[model samples]
Target chain A: MSTLAVAKKEFHDGIRSRVLAGLTVLFGAFMAGAAYYYTEITPPAGIQSSAEPQTIAVINSLIIPTYILLPIIGTILGYKSISGERESGSLKFLLGLPHTRRDVVCGKLLGRSGIITVSVLVGFAVGGLALYALTDAFQIVDFAVLTGVSILLGMVFVSIAIAFSSAVRSSTIATAGAISLVLVFLFFWNVVLTLVGYVAQELSLIETAQSQTPTWLQFFASLNPTGAYQTTSIYLLDNGTRSVPSNPPFYLEEWFGFVILAFWLVVPIGLAYLRFDRTDL
Target chain B: MPAIETIGLTKRYDGVTAVNELDLVVEEGEVFGFLGPNGAGKSTTIDVLLDFTRPTSGTVTVLGEDAQRESQSIRRRTGVLPEGCDLYDRLTGRQHLRFVNESKDADDDPDTMAERVGIPEAIDRKVGGYSKGMKQRLAFGAALVGEPELLILDEPSTGLDPSGAHEMREIVQEESARGATVFFSSHILGQVEAVCDRVGILHDGELVAEDTMEGLRNAMDREAVLTVEVNRVPEDAIAAVRALPGVSGLTTDGTTLSAHCRDGAKAAVINELEAAGASIEDFGLETASLEELFLAYTGDRPSRPIDKPTVAAGIDAAGERTEGHR
Candidate 1:
C-alpha cells in the first residue's frame, strides 16, 4: 500500500510538470508526422509498388527514431527520480512516514515505468491512426508487435536512468551518468568495438582481420540495448520476409534479443537498489 | 518503555564528529525539549532517531523498537516533522494531506486538518505558492495524522510568527495531554519553556545540561542583576559592593553600576553603595531572561556588560544538576 501511494504521488508530480507534458506532445506529433511521410510522401519502393502494400514501411520507419527518442524521454523522466528529492530534502519528508527505503526505490521504478509506457502508447496511437488513414494495408498484428517492442525499449532506458539516479547523491552526477550511457549505446559502442578489434588483430588474436564479421562480434554488438531492441522488434514482427543465418549458436539466435533487452531492463535497477538501500540519504 | 533512547550515540561526517558519545532518554508521555544552538548536533541526533542516518558507533531505540533494524515499525507508531525538509510544491495542501493519509492508512479529512493548523483558506492552493509559515503549518499538520503514539518534532516552530509559535506550543501541550510523547528540538528556549516537561541542552556535540523546568527556574531565580545610576563616581562603593556576600559580578560605566548578585544580596549591595557616600539617582532589578539562562547553560556567556569576575562560575554553580558538562 505504501509503495502504491508513493507511485501515485510520483505519477501525479510528472503529470503536473510542464516539461514532461511538452515532451509527450512532441513525441506524439513526431510519430504522427513520421507515419504520414512514410505512407504518403515516399514509401519504400517494393512495398509501395506492390499490389497490396503492408504496414511494413510504417513499422520500419519507427525503429530508428524510437531508438533515439525513447531513451532520451526515459532518461529525462528518471534521472532525477531519487537524487533530486535527496538534494531538496523532500526525501526526509518521504522517509519520515512508514515507507521503507525499498519502497521508495521500487516505487520510483514502477512510477517512471508507467510514465514511459504511457508515452509510448500515446505516440503509437497517434502514429497508428495516421498510418491507417493514409495506407490501405494496416497489418494490425505486425503494428501491434512494433508498438509493444517500443514500449519495452522505453522501459529499459527508464530502468537504466533510475539506476543512476538512485546510486548517486547529486542530480548532476546522475544526469551525466545517464547521458553517458545513452551516448555509449547510440554512437560509441561500435567505435569502441572496432578499436578493440584492431588491437586484437595486431596482437594475433584473430585469424582473418578483414574478412566477414565474426559471430562473436555480432553477439557483442547485440549487447547494446538500443540495437537489441531493433533486432527484437524485427524478430517478432517478421512475416517470413527477412533472411536468417543458417544454424547460428543458441546465444546468437534472433530470440536472444529478448534476453538481452530483459537483462538491460532488470540488472541495473537491481544493482542500484542494493546500494540505495544501504546508503544514508 | 522510554519513548526514545540513545546510548553512546555518535555520528561523524568525514572527520568532524556531529554528535559525540552521548546517552539520552525521553520517557513515555513526556514533552522532552531538545535544546541547542545551530550546529550543536541536535539535528544529527534526530536524524539517527528516525534512521535517516546511521550512527557511527552506538545504538538507538524509539518506542521500544531498534531504531536501525526496526525503523519501519518505529515510524509506523511515530509522526515526525523533520527539520529542513521540503514538501511537494506542485501538490495542493489538501492533496498533500490526502497523500499522507494514504501512506499512514488513515482517513483524515483535509479540511479539518487545514482548520486545525490554521490554514483553511490555503488548503486547496498548491504548496508552490505557500509562504514559509504556511508550509510549516502544513508540515506540522502532516505530523499529526494517524494519532501517533510519539511525535518527533525537530525545530517545529521555525518559520512561524509569534502567535503561530504559541499555537504550535498549545498543540504540543494538547498532544502531551493526549498521552503522546513529544520530543521537540529548538534553538530558542522560549518556544519550549512553557510546554516541555524536561529540557536538555546540547553544546558541541555533547549534552551540557538536563533538568525539569521547575529546577531550572529555581536555579535562575537565585541570580538577579541590580543596576544603579549614582550622582557621582565612587571607587570605594565599587569595592564595597564587590565585597557583598552574594555579589559575583560588578561593572561600572560613568555614573551607572550593575551587579550580578543573588536575590539575598540585593539589599545588602544597596546598603554598601549608600554607605560609601554615593547618592543613587535611580535603581532597578532585572531577572535573567530565558535566553540568558539558555546561554549560561550552553556556555556562550550571555550578552551583558563586561565581567569583573565573570559570572560563569556562579551560574555554573547554580546549574547544580549539570553532570559531565564542560
Candidate 2:
C-alpha cells in the first residue's frame, strides 16, 4: 500500500515535469517516422509493396528504433530516481515517514516503470495508427505483441538505470553509469564478443575459418539485451517476418531472448537493492 | 519509558567519531534543545535516533521500541522536519502535505495546515518557485500532520525571518503543552533559550553539559557578578558577604560594593547592606549569558576566530581509541 503511494507521487512528478512529456513527443515522432520509412518512404526496395503488418517491412523497422530509443528514455527515467532525492536530501523526508528502505526501492522501480510504460504506450499508439493507415495487411495480434515486447524492453533499461541510481550516491557517477550501460549494451557488446572470439579461435578452442564465432559464443552474444530485444521481437512476429532459418541450439533459440530480457529487468534491481539496503543513507 | 533514550550511543564514520558514547534522555512532555556548533555530532545523533545511520556500538530506544529493529512503529508516531532538505520542485505545498497525510493515514486539511504555518497564500504554487523560508514553512506544516507523539525538528528555523522563527517556537510550545515532546537542534543559542525546557550542549562529539536554565545558571557562577551602588561603601556588608560560603571574591570601591558569588550568596549580601545603614541607591546583577557558557564548554577561546578546523579527537565513545572491534 505504501509502495503504491510512493509510486503515485513519482508518477505525478514524472508527468508534471517536462522531461517525461518531451520523451512522449520525441518517441511518438520517432515511431511515426519509422512507420513512414518502412511503408511509403523506403518500401523495402523489391516487392513493390511488402508493406504487410506482420511482414519484415513493418515490424522490423518498429523493433529497430526501440533498440536505441528505449535505452535513452529508460536512462533518462531512472538515472536520477534515488540520487536526485539524495542530493536534494528529500530521501530523508520520505524515509522520515513510516517507510522502510525496501518500500522506497520498490516504489521507485514501480513508479519509473510506469512512466516508461506510459511513454511507450503513447508512442506505440501513434505508430500503430500509422501502420494501420499505411499497410493494407496489418495483423492486430503481431502489432499488440510488438507493443507489449517494446514496453518490456524499455522496462529492462529502467531497471538498469534505477540499479545504478540506488547503488551510487553521486548523480554524476550514476549518469556516467547510465551512459556506460548504453555504450556497453548497444555498441560495445559486439566488440567484446569479437575480441573474445578472436582470442578463443587463436587458442584453438574451436574450428578455424569454418567458423570465426563458436556456437556458445554466438549464443552468449545474442543474449546481450539489445540483441535479445531484436531476437525476441522477431520471434514474437513469427511466420515469414524474416527470411532467416530458425534451426539453432535451444539456448540460441528466440524464446531464450525473452528469458534474457526478463533477467535484465529483475536481476539488476535485485542486486542493487541488496547494496542499497546495506549502505548508510 | 522515556520518550527517547540512548545508552552508550556512539556513531563513527571510518576513524572519525561523529557521536561519542553518550547517554541522553528526553522525558514524555518537554522541549529539549539539542545545541551544538557545526559538525559537533548533533545531526549525527539525530540521524541515529531516526536510524538513518547505524550506530557504532550501544543501544537506543524511542517510545520503548528498539530504534533499529522497530523503527517503523517509532516513526509512525514521530514527525520530523529534516535539516537541509529540498522539497519536490514540481509539487505544490498542498500536494506535499497530502502526501504526508496519506502516508500516515491522516486526514488533515491542507488549507488548515498551510494557514497554521503561514503559507496559505502560496499553498497552491509549485515548490520550485517558493523561497527557502516558504519551503521550510511547508515542511514544518507537513510534519504536523496526525499530531505526532514526538516532533523532531532539525534546524527548523534556518531560513525563517524573525517572525517566522518566533512562530515556530510558539508551535513548539503548543506541541509540548499538548503532551508531545519536542526535540530540536540549533546552532544558535538565542533560538532555543526561550522555549527549551532543558538543553544539552554538544561539542566535539561529546555532551559537555545538560541542564535546565536555572541549573546552568547555578552551576556556572563566574557569571553572577553583582554590583551595588550605595551612598557610601558598606564595610560591614562587604565583610559579611566575604564571609559567605559561596562568595568567591568581593571588592569595595568609593561608593559601590561588588561581589563575585554563586547562587545563594546574593540574598545574604543584600540583607547585610540594609543592616549596615548604607542607603542603597541602585543595584545591578549580570549573570553569565548563554553565549559565554556555550563558549566555556566548547572551549573555543573568545580571543580566537571561530572558523578554526576542529581537530579530530581520535577518541572512541569509551574515551581512548582502542583497536579491538566490538
Candidate 3:
C-alpha cells in the first residue's frame, strides 16, 4: 500500500512537470514523421521500400531510431529519479512516512516505467494512425509487437538509469554513469567484443580461422538489452522475411531475447535496491 | 515506557563525530524540547531516532519499538517534521497532504489540513510558488496526518512568522492535550520556554543541562546582574553593598558600580549606595540571555566565533557539575 502511494505521488509529480508533455509531443511527432518518410518521401534504394509493404518499410526504418531514442528518453526520465530527490532533501518527506527504502526504489521503478510506457504508447498510436492514412497497410499484430518491445526496451534503460541514481549520492554522477552505460550498450558493446577477440587471438586463447560463433560469445551478445529488444521484436513479428541458421542453440534463439530483456529489467534494480536500502539519505 | 529513549547513541561522519555517546529519555505525553544552537548535533540525534541515518553505535527505541530494526512500525505511529527537508515543489499543497494521508492510511481532508495550517486559499497552488513560511506550514500540516501517537518536530518554527509560530505552538498544545507526546527541537530559549515541560540543552554533541522550566528560571533569577552609574564612588558604600544578603559580587570602577545579585537584592544595593552619599545617576538590571545561560551551564558561550583555551577545562568541569546536579 505504501509502495503504491509513493508510486502514485511519483507519477503525479511527472504529470505536473512539463517534461512529460514535452516528451509526448516529441514522440508523437517522431512516430508520425517516420511513417511520413516511408510513405511520402520514399527515400532511395537503400530502404528497399518498393519490395515490401509500406507498414513493414516504416517498421524497418523505425527500428534504428527506436533503439537510439528510447534509451536516451529512458535515461533522461530516470537518471535523477532517486539522487535528485535525495540531494534536494525532498527524500526526507518520503522516508518520514511509513514507506521503507525498498518501497521507495520499487515505487520509483514502477512510476518511471509508467511514464516511459505512456510516451511509448502515444508514439505508437500516432504512428499507427499515420501508417493507416498514408499507406493503407497497417499490420496491427506487427505494430503491436514492436510497440510492446519498445516499451520493454524503455523500461530496461529506466531500470539501468535508476540503478546508477540509487547507487550514488550525486545526481551528476548518476547522469554521467547512466548515459555512459547507454553509450556502451548502443555503440561500444560490439567494438569491445572485437577487441576482446583480438586480444584473445594475441594470447593464443583462440585460433584465427574460427569462423563459427562460439556458444559463450552468443550468450554474451544476447546480454545487451538493446540487442535483445531487436531480436525479440523480430521473433514476435514472425514475418519470416529474415533468415536464421538451422537448429541454432538456445542462446542464439529469439526466445532468449525476452529472457535477456527481463534480466535487464530486474537485476540492475534489484542491486540498486540493496544499495539504496543501506544508504543514508 | 518512555516515548523515546536512546542509550549511548553516537554518530560519526568520516572522522568527525556528529553525536557522541548520549543517553536521553522523554516520557510519554510530555512536551520535551531538545535545545541547541545550529550544528550542535540536534538534527543528527533526531535523524538517528527516526532511522534516517544509522548510528555508529548504540541503541534507540521509539514508542517501545527498536528504532533501527523496527523503524517502519515506529514511523507508522510517529509523525516527523524533519529539519532542512523540502517538499515536492511541482506538487500542490493539497496533493502533498493527500499523499501523506494516503501513505498513513488515514482519511484526512486536504482542505481541513490546509485551513488548519492557515493556507486554505493556497491549497490548490503548487508548492513551488509558496513562500518559505508557507512551505513550512504545509510540511507541518503534513506531519499532522493520522493523528500520530508521538510527534517528532525538528525546528518546526523555522520560516514561520511570529503568529505562525504561535499557531504551531497552539497545535502542539492541542496535540499534547489529546495525549500525544510532542518532542521538538529549537535553538531559541523563549520558544521552548513557552510550551516545553522540560528542555535538554545540547552542546558539542553532549547534553549540558536537562531541567524543568521552573528550575532553569530559578537559576536565571538568582544571577541577575545590576549595573548603576553613580555621581561619585564612595569607598564605604562598596563594602556595605558587598555585605548585603543575596548580593554575590560587587565591583567599582570610577563612578560606576555593578552588582551580581538575586532578583530581590537590587533595591538593597541602591539603598546602601545612596545612604553612603554616592548619589545614583542611573541604574539598570539584566537577566541572563540564553547565550549567558549556556555559559553559566557549560562555562563556554554557545556562539562559535570566540575560541578560548579554557573551553576544554570548561567542558570537563561542566560535565561534573551537570552530573552532580542530576
Candidate 4:
C-alpha cells in the first residue's frame, strides 16, 4: 500500500508537471500526422485499390509507430527512474524510509510504467481516430489487439530500462545505456541475425545450419527486450497474413514468441529487483 | 530499557575497519551525542544502526528489534537524517514532505511542520532553489514528521548558519521533550555539549570516553590552570605551590606564577602561595571545558591517531579495567 501510495504520488507529479502531458502531445501529434498523411495518399474506402489494402495500411501506419515510438517512450520513462534518484540524492532519502529495496524499485517501475502506458494509449487513440475519420468506422477489436501489442512492447523496454537504471549509478550513463539498449534491439540485432543466417547458409550444411542458426538467433534475439516484444507483436497482429518467419523451422509459432516476450518482461525485472535488494543504496 | 543498543558492532571495508567493536546504549527519552572527527566511524555507526550497512559482526537493537534482522520494523519506529542527503530538486518542499509523511503513514500537516522548522513560505518553492540551510531545515522536518520513537541524525547541522543551527538545536530539544530518544552525531563539541544529555567520544573506531559532560570532565581528572600575578615571585613559593596536594608543574615568569591544579584546588594553592611570602597582584583560574576534556582524553592530537586494536592484548586490558571498576 505504501509503495503504491508513493507510486501514485509520482504519477500525479509526473502528470501535473506536464511531463506526461508533453510526452502525450508529442507522441499523439507524430502518430496522427503520419496516419493522416498515409491515409490521404492511399484513399482506402470504396475506391478501386490494390489487394489487401487493410493489411498494407495497417502495417505501414500502425507498425511503424508501435515499433519505433513505443520503445522510445519506454526508455524515456524509465531511463532515469533509479539513477536520477541517486544523482539527486533522493534515493538515500527514499531508502531511509521503512520500505524495502524491492518496494522502491517496484514503485518506481509501476509509476513510470503507468505514464508510458497512458502515453502509448493516447497516441494510438489519436492515430486510430485519424484513421477512422479518413476511412469509415473501424472495428474496435483490431485497435484493441494493436494497442495490446504496443503495451507489451512498452513493458519489455520498461523492464530493460529498470534493470539498467538499477545496475548503473550515474543518470547520464543509465540514460545512454537504456537508449542504446533499445536502439540495439530495434535495429542492430536484426542486421547481426541476418549476417549470421547468411554465413550459416553459405557453409554448405543445410541441415546442420538449420539446426544451429535459428536456435542461436532466437536466443540472441530474445536478449533484446524490444526485439522480443516486436517479434511477439508481429505474431499477435499477424491475422494469418504477412508475418516474419521463425528463424529456425523448428522454432515457429506465435506462442513461442509470446513466451519470449513474457520472459523479457519478467526476467530483467526479477534480476533488477535481486540486484537492488542487496545493493547498499 | 535502552531504546537502542549495539554490542561488539564492527564494520570493515577492504581491510580497513570503519567501525570496530563498538558497544553503545541509548536510553529512551535521552539525547545521546555521538562525537568523532571525520572518518572516525560516526556515520558508519549510524549506517549500521539504520541497517544501511550490515555490520561485520555483533548485534544492533533498535526499539527492542534487531536492526538487521527486523530492520523494517526498526526503521518504522525510527526516523533518519542521513549525511549529505540530496532531496528531489524538482519537487517543491511541500511535495517532499507530503511524500515522506505518506510513506511513514503519519498524519502530518506539512504546512505546520514546515512552519515549525522555519521554512513555511519556502515549502512551495522547488527544493533545488532552496539554500543549504533551508534544505537542512527541510531534512530536519522530514526526520521529525512521524514523531518517531528514535531519531537518528547524522551531522544534521552541517550546512546550517548560526541561527539555523540554533533552530535545529531547539528542534532536537523539542523532540527529546516529546519523549523521543534522539541519537545524533556531530563533530562540534560545543553543539553536543549544549544539546546532549550524555555524549560519547569515538576515536579511531572505538569509543574512548562515554559520560555526561560533567562526568567526562571528571573522569579525565582535568586540572585548572591558575595564573597568578604577584609583586615578587619566589622559588620557594613556586615549590610550595607545586607541593600543594592537587597542584603540579608550577612555572613562574618574574612576577607571574602559573600552575595546573585540580578544579577545586585553586583556593588552597593560592592560600598556600600567599602564606609563603608572595603578594598576589591578581589571579585567574581556567576551568576544564569540553574542548579541553576532549583534548586531554585524545592526547591533544589534531588528527585521529591510527592504531588498530590488538585482539588479545585489548581483551586483557579491558578485562583488567572491568575488574578494577568492579
Against the true structure, whose TM-score is highest? 1
For residues A55-165, could you state the per-residue lDDT of candidate 2 as single tens digits?
555767887777789888988898899988988999999999888888888888888889888999899899888888987777777888888988898889988998999
lDDT of each: 0.85, 0.82, 0.83, 0.75
Off by over 4 Å in 1: A49-53, A199-204, A207-210, B223-287, B306-326
lDDT of 4 by residue, A1-281 (tens): 76886687667555554555776788888878877766677644633354344644553466676678778877777778788887776676777888777777788777777777888889888988887786654556666777887787787777778888887777888888888877777778788777776676777534553544555555655656555555666665555656445554444444566777778777887887887666655
- Superposition TM-score, candidate 1 onto the true structure: 0.86
**Could you give candidate 2's fraction of true interface contacts?**
0.77
Better of 2 and 4 by TM-score: 2
What does fnat come to for each candidate? 0.87, 0.77, 0.89, 0.66
lDDT of 1 by residue, A49-97 (tens): 6533356756778776688889989989889889999998889999999
Each predicted complex: what DockQ? Answer: 0.73, 0.66, 0.71, 0.43
Root-mean-square deviation (CA) per prediction = 7.2, 11.2, 8.7, 10.3
Q: Give the Cα error of residue A126 in candidate 3, in Å.
A: 1.3
What is the Cα-based lDDT of residue B175 in candidate 1? 91
Q: On residues B1-326, what C-alpha lDDT tens digit does candidate 2 reach at each position?
A: 69899999988898999999989999889899999888899989988888888899989999889999999888999998999778899999988998898888899999999999999999999999999999999999988999999999999998999999999999999898898999999988889989998999998888988999667766665445556666776556667777878765565566666565565666666667767877666555555456656655664532222223321222122112111211
Task: Estimate the lDDT of model 1.
Answer: 0.85
Task: Report the C-alpha displacement of residue A255, candidate 1, in angstroms.
Answer: 2.0
Please tell me which predicted candidate would have the highest DockQ against the true structure. Answer: 1
Error of 3 at A114 (Å): 1.0
lDDT of the structure predicted as candidate 4: 0.75
